[model samples]
Target chain A: MDAVAAEWWKLRSVRSTYWTLSAAAAVFVFVLLLAFQMAHIWDGLSVERRADFTLRPLQELGGWAAALCLAVLGVLSVTSEYRSGMIRTTLTVVPRRGRVLAAKAAVVGTVALVAGEAVSIGSFLGTRLVVGDRPFPDQGASIAHDLPDFAIVGASVAVFALLGMSLGVLLRSTAGALVSVVFLWHVLPLLVFQLPEPWNERVGSVMPGALPGQIAGRSADSSIYGDLLPPGAAAAVMLAYALVPLMLAGFALSRRDA
Target chain B: MCGGPSRTTVDRMIEVRELTKRYGATTAVDRLSFTVRPGTVTGFLGPNGAGKTTSMRILLGLDAATSGEALVNGGGYAALRRPMREVGALLDAGAVHGGRRAFDHLGWLARSNGIGARRVAEVLEQVGLAGVARKRVGGFSLGMRQRLGIAAALLGDPGVLMFDEPVNGLDPDGVRWIRELMRSLAADGRTVLVSSHLMTEMELTADRLIIIGRGRLIADTSVRELADRFRRGVLVRTPRPAALTAVLAAAGGSVESMPGGALTVTGMDVAVIGDRAAARGIPLYEVTPHSASLEEAYMELTAGSTEFGAVAS
Candidate 1:
């Protein structure tokens, strides 16, 4: 419990925490504006072009940017200490290194959950506000869609934040961890899509790029791009990305000298 | 070892036995053994790269020992229920986030140890940083950072305190302040181990000195004893050198002629030599006594063990 409080204090005391969270929230609002602008332009397009306009993925876009922000926040949680040489002080205060990591994980995960839910839900509601009145061709397919997708966006972000924690702990360098997260989340999927035929579908589906559709429990309306894991399977896979690295980080942290 | 409050009493002592730490093939610390008892500041003296910091890190549980144990109180530092409340260490003053305010840095450390916020304020005030508590640490000077580090160490009011070069990069006033702080902490019956590569820093402060060289213990004795053991001899200069030398030799004082016509005499006090010289009717020009300092002793002790030495061509 003391560890938790200390971690909380550590997370909130830094300027980067507020800066990154605010930037993520700003991105959410900007993406909402962009989504609404696209929705407004849907009426002027021809039938073929109109069919291509899908608003569901627009809600997920804001979450994507927010995940990037949270990932940076998570990486900084540990890497900042290393950069500042605060790890020695921290470890000195709490000799059980594992407990310190656990507390950091909890704090980052909690902040990510709260901030993620707020930004994602706000994006969804804002999109609804702009596009709700003007009905598209195939609207209102399921009434239950809004809340679940909203919740999923928040969960996906929180998971990414946890993944950042593990990477930060493992790398112990800010630029190194941040680059690794970028490679895993963005660059890996781009390379995966370049693979030949069904292999692209097979690999890209499990990558973080397919997370939005997998987490939303449905494919995007624009294109049937690849073979995606089922919702439960996708959730498990996403959870693995966070949990596996976290476990490894905890083990290394306990065994390795500070 | 038996465990309980009785064990706790024993645990309050910092004991490092056969502690060895090796990095790859290079042994940083080899079979180092020592105990820091309460009520006095034990100066951990050594030249640079003498394994002083490595041993202290092991004691703080920041680094794992390859073989042997470093215990605070009676158990390992990790096994302590409230480590900060039992042992406080200022290993590196730079181990603080610059973006955070000074108060927040110590405040978080305080919270980690379950110490009250009021204690944080008290320590900041104690370290003379209370006025700048809200200021960002990025703007703080190195001396200020040191004070903040000391404040953090004192937050828990621990029984055992360890400082690695606590006086480094400090002004004369700051150095005196830390000296006084260490003395007072020891006076309160708390165990204190302060490490410094500079022997002069420890000479005035430490009661007992643990001098190491090349990761090996050289001497563990009182500060005064070290000075006595390494005393160079009294140097005497006289206008009537031959007569003075003859009288000093007759009086059982070994004398060696130094450059520029001064005689270095040992095994006799300056007063006795003066009395004898007066009795012999020898004209005394200059009589100066040279006492070997802790710095000289330390240099002599670690002369061969220095990792890097300037070669005189």
Candidate 2:
């Protein structure tokens, strides 16, 4: 745990991570406003429904933010080390490569969760002020409020970040890991959904992005992910996706040289 | 028996014994063994592809040996709880994060090792990189990058240190500074093992040398002892080769003729060569002691035994 705390300090001390999180915040706010503007285009029943209605759209926006910010957070967190050859330096300080990998994984996930949640809440509130309380529920009654959505999406962001981190660790090269996770987490899942019906249903449940959607709940397109996985199932899948690379990387770390 | 030097001094002796590394059919290191003691610079000497880098990597736990082991503070580098505090090594100056600022790069290493954040600044200054500490490492010249690497190695202030080819690309002044740095580090009772191909450079820096060729130990000796035992004969040049030759013949000395009216004299000292020349009134142009350079002697000794000669490397 001391090693883990040390790893955390190293991660947070870097400027690249702050810039990446800031980018995510800026993008999340921009997209939240865009989602709020789109809410006006849809025909709704009542002002009350409209106020309550923004929750879904905001949730969706937050989910997408969680999903995409991973591309930045995950790649930058681990692959940036590779790009700078800082991983070797990191390994030198903590030669138990397994412990180092775990420390990095834990650090990346926890930071992403916190950063992702902060960015989501800031963007949600900033956009709420711009979009008006009348339409998006300044009522502040339901857990569907910005705070809960922030928690859920924060978890989703953490999942994606860990997923990306796992891929980064599995593939030591920067370009290779980034390209692989982008394809596996983003492109491959899209390609998999377009496949034959049962295949899409089956594969979507296990894909990395599926974890985020399961946590946030699927849209009308829920069928696209084989009868929307329960939050528990999604969490399990997320843990699985994150842990496989971690374990493989750990084994490789121990078996092979640093 | 190979407890090495870590036991005696404040330094943790890095002991590599019977360490062998192989890649498929190619045997890279063959039962190589040596001890790097603290309080003196131990030079890891070898020609190109002589497995100096491989051996260092194995010792640092960056690469696994095919057999045997390397111990840092009585355990493998990977087993150490605080590896940087136990063993700090720079296998290559180029093995660094070029995109990171020098201070940030070293800072991360410091953080991981549980060292104080202040050590980063101190080490950066120690390596003369305080001015460029915030600059991107990619922009540094090879010498500056070497300094950054040294800074990283020194971040934890560990007792054991290893560097391979640390002077690969440096101005003469930078090279001299590194030599002095190694000596000073050793003077502080830290175990410092440095590797270089240049014997002259090692001659100035290393208190003792571990010379290897073809992944095998050639000699583990000191500079003066090497010079004495190698027995490279004295050189006596003369403007009158025939006169010197006859004088050598009468004096029970052997003189070998050279193409440029020179004589390679054996079985005599420079003073004797000078006295003989003076007595015969033969003008002596040069009477220099031509001790075989450790590099040349090393080459001659390993001439038939190198693993990387006459092969496309």
Candidate 3:
């Protein structure tokens, strides 16, 4: 508990934490403007063309963009310590390396989770309010019905945060860990999308961005992701994305000298 | 500044025994052993790359030893639940995040050891950093960072303290402040181990010295012992050199004639030589006791052990 408090104090004391979270929150404003623009364009489109326009992408944009921001937050939390050589002081104070990493993961993970939920749900609601009564093809679902999916989307942000911290601990370099995170968050999914048929959908089904929809039991027909896995399997994979990397990071931290 | 009494009854000692550390093929610390006791400042002296930092790192559990034990208070540092309360260390003053405020930097460290925030402010005031407590460390000079580091070390009021090259970039006033602080800490019955490459610094600050070279212990003795070990004889000058030499020799002092009609007399102190000369009615010009300086003694001890020696032109 002391370690957790210390880690929380350390995270909150730094300016980078606020900077990254504010960047994550900026996605909300961007989504609202995009929603306003989409509503403006919806009025000009003929009824037939209106059936094709969907707000799903703008709704998911908040959580997706925040994943990158919060992940950067996660990366800096550990890598900054390494870069400044403060890791030795940290280890000296709390010699149980596992506890230190766990405390850090706990603190970073919780902040990302809360921010993720806010941005994800906030974007969804804000966009819906702006495009009120438009009744687009994909807007038929009630707020209560789509709320679970947005919640899962928020949870995915925490997963990305843990993954970023793990990479930071393993690489101990901000640039290296951020490159790896960006690869996982944006680049690899795009590359996976280009793979040959059944394989493309099969691999895309497990991508971090794709997991939220799958876990929420939503069909991925209009999206780049696939809907192959059952909800349980998708949820398990999401948990693995957060846990597996953290376990590896813990192992590496304990075995290596600070 | 002294705080409350230490929480533990454990004898405050830093014992490193047969400790060895290796980085791939390079040996950093090799079977090194030393014990630091309370109530005195023990200077961990070594030339650069002589494994002084490496040994301290292993002791602090920041690095693992290849084989051996570095016990603090008769146990491994890792086993201490609140290590900061038992052993405070300032390994590198620059190992701080530039973005953190001076108060917050020490604040988090204090929180880690379950120390109260009041102690943080007290230590900041003790180290004379209270005015800049809210300032970002990025704008601080090297000396300020050093004082901040010392404040962090004092936060928990630990029984044992270790500092590495703490005076590297300090002004003369800061140097004197650290010297007095170290002496006062030792006087308070706390074990203090200060590492430095300068024998002159240690000569004034350290009661006992542990000199290492090439990751090996060169000399583990007190300042007085080291000075006595390197003592040269007394030098005497007189117009009647032959008379003085005969008088000193009669008094069982071995006298050698110097080039300028002077004599180097061993086995007798200046007082004995002066008395013998006065007894013989021989006028004495000068009688001075000579001993090797601690800096020269340190150089001779670590002559070939310097890792990055340059070839003479």
**TM-score of each model, in listed order:** 0.93, 0.86, 0.97
Which candidate gets the maximum lDDT versus the true structure? 3
Residue pairs with backbone overlap in model 2:
A51-A135, A84-B97, B6-B13
Error of 1 at B65 (Å): 0.9
Calculate each model's fnat, 2 decimals: 0.82, 0.51, 0.84
Please give, for residues B4-61, the per-residue lDDT of candidate 1 as tens digits: 3443458558888988999999788889898889889999998788889899898888
**lDDT computed for candidate 1:** 0.85
Local accuracy by lDDT, each model: 0.85, 0.74, 0.92
**In model 1, what lDDT does residue B229 have?**
91
How far does residue B285 in candidate 3 sit from its true spot (Å)? 2.5
Per-residue lDDT value at A250 in model 3: 97
Candidate with the greatest DockQ versus the true structure: 3
Off by over 4 Å in 1: A43-51, A220-225, B1-11, B237-248, B258-262, B270-289, B309-313
Model 2, A138-227: lDDT tens digits are: 335543544564566566677678777767766767678767767775688788889896788778777765665565554425334553
Q: Which candidate's TM-score is highest?
A: 3
DockQ of 1: 0.82
- State the lDDT at B65 in candidate 1: 94
* lDDT of candidate 3 over A49-138, digit per residue (tens): 988899998999999999999999999999999999999999999999999999999999999999999999999999999999998788
CAPRI band for model 3: high
Candidate 2, residues B1-313: lDDT per residue as tens digits?
1134445552468788898999898787889988888879999887777888888877777788899877776668777777777677886677665656787777767777778878888988888999998898878999998898888888778888898888888999899989999999888878899988778789999989898887889899988888877765666677778878998878988778767777788788889989878888999888777778777777776686666555421
Docking class of 2: acceptable
